[model samples]
Target: MEVTGRRWLLLHADEPGNCPEPSTTPDDYMGGFCAFNFTSGPAAGKFCWDQQPDYSAFRESSFGHGILEVKNETHALWIWHRNQDLYSTAGDMIYIVRQPERCLVESEVP
Candidate 1:
């Protein structure tokens, strides 16, 4: 996601096992995930800024806040906000999930 700045970083990790530490930047962390490339879609295998990240089908630039509702181990809900909206309003939303079986190292059963 092309955020406003470095402070707002949206990263995709295998759950949270490879996420950055609270004290350091995401790219500067000592995580073993080196392949920060698009694995699918039009920009497959390419790095950041080289092309549009097709994995994100829709992206909008809005001035709004966000709410994160962490569900159980497998699911979570992300809700965005805007100042001009109603009390319980959401400018955007995403339902995140962890599917390790789809991210396995080498499973060709598909």
Candidate 2:
């Protein structure tokens, strides 16, 4: 995900165990998660601005808010702000889930 000011955050649903220790700037500590990259219309693998225009999708403004609702242990809904509202407005919303079979690494046997 692209954080503001041209900085970028890399995350993959397949291997999220390697996620960094959240962030301190803006004080939003991001926990590990699995999400669907709708920026590319469900293409193969995952989607990020490094290889696609996903960043442009939120080019309007960098300052935004979000709400994470955990429906279960493997599913969540993310709602992002558009920086254009006054009283908790809605912008982007998506249903994210941990697809173990589709987005995970297999254990190696010795």
Candidate 3:
């Protein structure tokens, strides 16, 4: 689904043993999840969650601010800064690379 102009993926663990069943009470639960690339898109060959990065910093109820700085048409810098962190510090950061030629349709290109 799309929220605030950003797209989100709903990941689920395919193997029962890889994840635990949902709990009735509110608690932190860790599980394996995966996001596959679209069959045909700029992100056609990219995948995530198979070797997932640590996301404990952004856990439930965590408050943080994020910044996405587009370096170019194909590269962007994403940073997440927690409320408790210093202004110059980044809790997490990543470079987002886009494959417009492979992912964007002709009509969508500027």
TM-score of each: 0.46, 0.42, 0.42
Please estimate how well model 1 matches the true structure, expressed as its whole-model Cα lDDT. 0.59
Which of the numbered candidates is closest to the native, going by highest lDDT? 1
In candidate 2, stretches whose alpha carbon ends up further than 4 angstroms from where it belongs are 1-43, 46-50, 53-58, 103-110
Query: How many clashes does the backbone of model 3 have?
Result: 2
Task: List pairs with backbone clashes in candidate 2.
Answer: none
lDDT, candidate 1, 14-97, per-residue tens: 334443443344343443233433466653553333344466668766677898999986679999898678786888889876
How much lDDT does each candidate structure score? 0.59, 0.57, 0.56
Off by over 4 Å in 1: 1-39, 43-49, 53-61, 102-110
TM-score-better candidate, 1 vs 2: 1
lDDT of 3 by residue, 1-110 (tens): 33555666544554333443333322434222223334444334344123333543356465888999999977999998888877569888999876665545234346
The residue pairs in collision within model 3 are: 41-103, 42-103
